[model samples]
Target: MATTSPSERLLKTICGSCLILAPAVLLVGGLLHPEETTNAARQFEIIVANLGRWELAHWLIAASMLLMIGAVVGLAHLLHEHRPTEGIIGGATTMVGVMALFAIASAEAAIVPQIGRSGDAQLFASIVTSGGFWVLLGPVLLLPLGLIIMSYGMYRSRVAQTWVAGTVALGSAAFAVSLPTGSPVAFAIGLVLMFVGLARVGWSVLAETDEQWHHPPQMGAQLAG
Candidate 1:
């Protein structure tokens, strides 16, 4: 058992919570989402008219992305322990991507909802529904890019099992791929993969922490020495 700092334990907890809960909230929002097709104005009307309908999903999705940044950073800390001299560039890129993801999520959620508040039906209908290019492209590129970087760093760090690192990286890529495909089911799978991979890393760290708590390294070292 090895020692873990308080920051490490907290990071593991936050990352684990985000990994476990983000997807669940997103899934619920997806389920609660309106299933019918309507004109942009009509859709905007519904969204504005009933914030309750999709607000949870909106917040959850944004929050999840925000937390992902933490997850990346926390995982990086562990991976750094193994490969001190390698993977700095990848980690920095991933951090930038995560920041971009948060910004995108925040901007989109804020803007789209404003249409509702404005009560301009024509404007809502007339306005763009694409959520802007940056928002659209942010997750498609940034999120996966971060995860892949984290995965690479983890692999290089030798902190994670080969399969764990590989699966997580693959899952991140798969999720990113599904984003552009415009398929809800496929998107869900990607989210699942993101959650799965993150959960693996977070959980591993927590487990290690618990082991260290129960069996401190000093005790083992004393025995060995």
Candidate 2:
């Protein structure tokens, strides 16, 4: 049997963990989120009332984005052999979207809390109305788009179960739409589905032997020959 390198083993562990943990963390964050309202002042009041939970939730969400970056790259690597084009494009696009969402979550966790602490509803409202906020938010749409593309690649490559790919695509779309539409029910459903899909992938990764994880079967065969 071919030996697995230490680095490969570590990489596999990290990616597998991220795939499982990212969605789970995001779910916790979503569940912890306080009530939101259309009114800026009312939203600020809600934040103030549940300050600790609010900050923790956004911070968790930001962390999940960072974790998801690793998960997406791992997925791309898995798909590269069978569907290189989709793997690369989907990974890059998803990375950009995840990073943008990370910024938004960070701002909410760090800056919004400060604004609420200052009791500046008008300032918060002004910031929201300003074009810059929406500009920052727009890239988030890329997340669902990338997920759908990636899921299609997974389906075509037969790397994952068809149901898994379908669930991820549907969940990502629902999650993205829920954000702008303020549909908490959809958000929760999306996260649950995503968790189910990703956890299966993660489990598969974790089940791989170090040698199997390090080299694709074809590559291993080539090396053996």
Candidate 3:
């Protein structure tokens, strides 16, 4: 019996983290919409414990951010060196960027004071809607874009159940549409679907790890007889 190497362990850890984060990213981000019910933000604030259990929620959100950051780093690494089909790298990188933005927004929402404050709501809304918020559109748009790319990549790689890849694209599109409509429930459902799609991707990747490993060759050339 042989022991696992550090790189292998790290890869597994990263993949595991991504599997866990796929849904969470969607969940926390789903709650950041200002257009949703006023209670939406309030609910998130309370979820983050800014209202009821301050210390507990604060730690929870902080931990969530840390985990997301780690997952993003792992995602970046997984995409950085891999020679996937055209646009797959770009698309996955875009997803990483989106996750980064989502993490930032989550952090902002988590730490802000939840108590009564005049004019703060208006200011927050402006911030969330302006370029700063609109910049979020990059990630928002890229999620589906990346999913489409990943789906295509899987198809090109001749992987089974290619149809599953399409779910990410569909889910992202649904989530995007739900946003402007001011329907948090729809957004949550969309994210749930997106997570399912991601889970499929994760499962496929993990299950096929041995079949997919692509480590570089050692620096030596040998002539064939």
Tell me, by TM-score, which candidate is best.
Answer: 2
Where does model 2 exceed 4 Å of error? 214-225
Number of clashing pairs, model 1? Answer: 1
Candidate 2 residue 162 C-alpha distance from true site, Å: 1.1
TM-score of each: 0.71, 0.91, 0.61
lDDT of 2: 0.81
Q: Clash pairs of candidate 3?
A: none
Q: Rank the candidates by lDDT, best first.
A: 2, 1, 3
RMSD of each: 5.9, 4.1, 8.1
Flag clash pairs in model 2. none
Model 3 lDDT per residue over 1-225, tens place: 235567876775666457567556546545543333434345344433333343333344445445544443433333433324434564555556566555654555454444213325545555445666455555655655555555455444434244554665576667667654656666777777767766654554454343243331111111000
How much is 5 displaced in model 3, in angstroms?
Answer: 3.2
**C-alpha lDDT score of every prediction, in listed order:** 0.59, 0.81, 0.50
Better of 1 and 3 by TM-score: 1
Summarize candidate 1's per-residue lDDT along 1-225 as a digit string, tens digits. 466678656766776566556545544544565432335656776787676555566566667666656665556556554553334555566666656655655654676567677777676655556466435466447657766776776666556666666776887677677555546666666666666666665555455554542342221122121
Q: How close is candidate 1 to the true structure, as a TM-score?
A: 0.71
Could you give candidate 2's per-residue lDDT for residues 1-225 as a string of tens digits?
A: 767778877888888888899989989999998987777778878988888998999999999998998789777866788878888999888888898889999999999889888888899889877877668667887877787788888788776777878888888888888878889989999899888887777777777776656543332122121
